[model samples]
Target: MKTTITPRVRTLVLLFLAVVGMLFAGAGTASAHAALTGSDPSSGVVVNKAPTQVSLTFSEKVATNNDSLRVLDPKGKRVDVGKPSNISGTTYATQIRSGLPDGTYTVAWQVVSADSHPVGGAFTFSIGSPSKTTVSAAAEQDVGGGLVGGLYGFGRYMSYAGFIVMVGGAAFVLACWQRGAGVRALQRLVVSGWVSLTAATLWLLLLRGSYTTSGKFGDIFDLNLLGQVLQTKTGASLVSRLLLLAAAALFIAVLFGAYDKREDEEKRDLTFGLAIGGGVVAAGLAASWALSEHASTGLQPGIAMPVDVVHLLAVAAWLGGLTALLVSLYRAPADNPVGRATVQRFSRLAFGSVVALVATGIYQSWRQLGSWSAFTDTGYGQLLLVKIGLVALLVGIASISRRWTGRLADSDTDTAKAETVVEETAAAEEHEPEKEHVTASAKTGGSSAASGDPKRAAQLARQQVAVDTTRQKRLRDADPNLFGLRRSVLAEAAVAVVVLAVTTALTTTEPGRTEEDAKAAKASSSSSSSSSSGALTLDMSFDTGGKDGKGIIRVDIDPARVGGNEMHVYVQRPNGRAFDVPEVKVAFTLAAKKIGPLPVTPDRITTGHWAANGIQIPMAGDWKISVTVRTSDIDQTTVDKNAQIG
Candidate 1:
């Protein structure tokens, strides 16, 4: 028999297609996580004179506290004269004192993205000539590390898991599996989800305090630190989530009768009110996550934040419902009518949720990754691809469950039709016999024992045939499709857990835009280094063991422009004695440009002296020059020096 598509099913299918079409139609330009895009005086650049101020530009508006931006001289002394000023929406600048010395300076900066996440980095620029100082880049402030960091990540994961369980479980009870509403196992799942979310939120608050303060485990309970964090937007978001959880607890208690021994069927009005109120609270809770995450900072916050909330809810509903379905399948009888009905209902609900999830995910991907290249080039984009692949697999598994549901529906239809046939046959046999008896009475003018014998026998035979047919239908081999569906749903739920973990990790990664910008800056700096005029000189020291353990190796690159150049090196002992080595060689590499370590075999001009002409400098940047000397077969040592091409 052909299956008829009900009007309700058609409506749902239309809605699903419409939403999907709208998502594809509204696809827009991509964006990325907030990151530094450009800066004044540019990193690794050589300026003719000291800049009076340094400016940093980010891809999005950011927030910062005092000391968020600083400039340090070659000697590691702070040179920035005052606190940074927000020159524009995404630009921050800090002034430096006039008449500064001509030396390399490092710019260190840390700021909070609009969404409340902290980002920081450091780079160097030179005034006049590059110096030989060993000042390292500014180190990032530790938010949390080791055990604390692990715990924080775990807490975040728990929060996500809890949301899916609580929201999804409650939705399943109200919509699909109403018969299982009062079951203790289902009730515990909801209660556990609620408790987990509340505890995770509170734990995160304390961890955030320690993260922003001293990055020490001991500071987790610091009252002052907690007070400071509570003043920030992140703190406010967490607090709001806690409040929503509290309200949800009340809704779950009253609506589901979680605390009562008996079902509260008399309070239908109260149940309805609690449901509507609970939905509002749940939405508010989702909004809290959006407010403190990448959605609020990266792209069009007005649109991205709301879409993120929807995306989160849809994921919870689908995955959470799957979890509930698995539990129901395990506990209920294989052929239970209620269990079968609940599975069919949940299948429909999950289909709708999946459509919504896909739509929102597409929009989010566009907002976060600006270009196609980012998909392979950036870590964030790579992780997103993995998530997409996993979701596709999950969808494939869900299709199997859907197929099984259809089979089950068909089986039910066949059984109902057989029962109807049996009922009709019995009704016909009763009425036919009565009519035959009336005819016989009229013909014989008196009651007869064998009245209408043939007709009665035919009627009885037809009734027996109907009874046999009904029994055959009832005895048909049981379908194993429901068992198969239960297994498929279980598989989907397992995969969903992995997806959630990946999502949590993605949130903490640097945005692709920042990584791309950093790569571009490095390439630009290398290109500029090759275009300068002047010879480059570098001093290196080597320990060759024995009496001549300490020796000085000096290199000279005449007119050290890119392409061919003459290179020379001199070696001397610490006491000004000529360090005579049997063989000496020089190797050069420009790592930033991925240039090779080209060996330059210089001729021994004199003792402790070497020279080579036609040495290729290649494209410049900071090149590492290594000088190797062999005093004996077993006593050889190499020393390295940085040769600034400019």
Candidate 2:
């Protein structure tokens, strides 16, 4: 005996494998929705004096709570003193304790992007000099803690899957196959969709707080955390979804119970009402996402939100309906096989959904990308390209399904005509006289007329058996058109699963426009900082042979140009505090011109500060600036840098 896999089992296997593959592919890296642009004292930069506050600038606006920002000193102690705030457009700041000890400190921040996704990261900056940080390496993990990120991603995927299934399944029953409501398989599909969405919404709401702030697993269950989540836009949208689901439940109940039981004529009247009511509920559900996610916060949000809702509804109707159709084909009762008209109607619906998807997708792509280069430059854009390719493949398969649908429709029409002709002839024969029946007995091959003669009746019995065998053979062989359509639809559905997964991943990725804007903002901030200081400063780290020789050297050349200039040098130990060294030396040479190696002797102004006035540079060119430091009589090292003197 051999075991064979059925179409239904194959479909399940495909879906399971696709889901597992998607999860495994993305497990190693989960991108953040908001990107950090710049930070004050900048990561790895050292300041002479401790600043009163630490500020960060992001690519987009972000929501903050009390614990959104934190600072840890060299000793891994909390040093921040106030709540983080939006001090300016896209810039947030938090005050730190005054007179912080000179050492490298870590800034850890987590906040909700305008799109309602949580993003967090950590970077280190020094007060007086770079130090060996004591903060745990985990502080720099930018994604929501690994487990939390994975769970959140799973919830997001489920929400999308649920919306498509529920909305699409209901739409198919209402628009394509009114009788589908009575199909148990379809009924389960729609109900499972609702349950999945409801559960996912609850999960996201519970986890939002922890995901945005601490990334701690234990924080997800803290009841107090719910309060904070509810205050945010994402929370509000989730609550709205639950309310809408209540309305959806009523819709589902009416569709499968009362509507299924109604007479065909009665259903016609109720369908108009149900369609209107269901459409509104579906749009509302779509709006719940549009109001909180990427569409609500991006450029032209007023337009984008409505477009996004349309996009989502189109996806549900197309992909979700494909799933429903596939199930009905494979699992509908043999007595009530899926009709050709139903498939044709869905073909029309899917076409319309595709039109809407394309229109809305173009607008969304423009809104998020802002430029052509972003298509290849950003993760969000790259993922979108992958989705586009998958959708194209799905559409190609749908075309094959449409052709098969057309053939099935034609076959059904011919079969119906032949059946009608057979019925009319049978009725005519029943009304004919006995003489007419006897006259036509040879051609009609009727058992009744031949029963009068033993030989004729025996001959008729054999002929009847042969005719019945032929009819059974035809019935045993499935319709080729229907089989082809089912196969094409299956392929479409399989591709749809992968497309949906990519779509879920897109939601968490930072848009290309946002990433570009962040880079621009960082450049502008750096330029402003450099202009304000009015000095060409070079910072370098050095280590001598001595036990405590690791430290940073800051060389500042005021109005660094050809001819006369003033130079200042400061040294600090790894703990970031100013420290004295055995000796320090500085010199410069214009390597391009083979100029002299000019030596500048600087007198010590303080323990770690030294200065040289009226230092001369003979020409403006790339000059090699070398600094040598001696920590002990035998422990000395030299470092070099090339700088423009003009």
Q: Per-residue CA lDDT of candidate 2, range 1-646, in tens?
A: 1112275567667785677566645654455667676677576667778999999877669998887888998778899987898897777999988878888899988787889877777878887777888784656654564677777778888899999999999999999998888999999999999999999999998888777766678999988888978988889999999999999999999999999999999999999999999999999999999999899885778899999999999999999999999888766654456778899899999999999999999999988887677889888889899999999999999988988888875536645644554565446546767434444554555555555666775665665554434332233225666667777887888888888888887887888776765554444334421312556776655656454565567788988877789899888753356869868899998877898688877889999998899998888877878889888888988766566677
For model 1, the run of ten residues with the poorest summed lDDT: 23-32
lDDT of 1 at 149: 57
**Model 1: per-residue Cα lDDT over 226-307, one tens digit each:** 8878888889999999989989998778645742333547444445665578668878988999998888864477898999
Off by over 4 Å in 2: 1-11, 24-29, 410-477, 521-646
Winning model by lDDT? 2
Whole-model lDDT values for every prediction: 0.70, 0.79
What is the C-alpha local distance difference test score of candidate 2? 0.79
Predicted structure 2, TM vs. truth = 0.72
Q: Backbone clashes in each candidate structure, one number apiece?
A: 0, 0
What TM-score would each prediction reach against the true structure?
0.62, 0.72
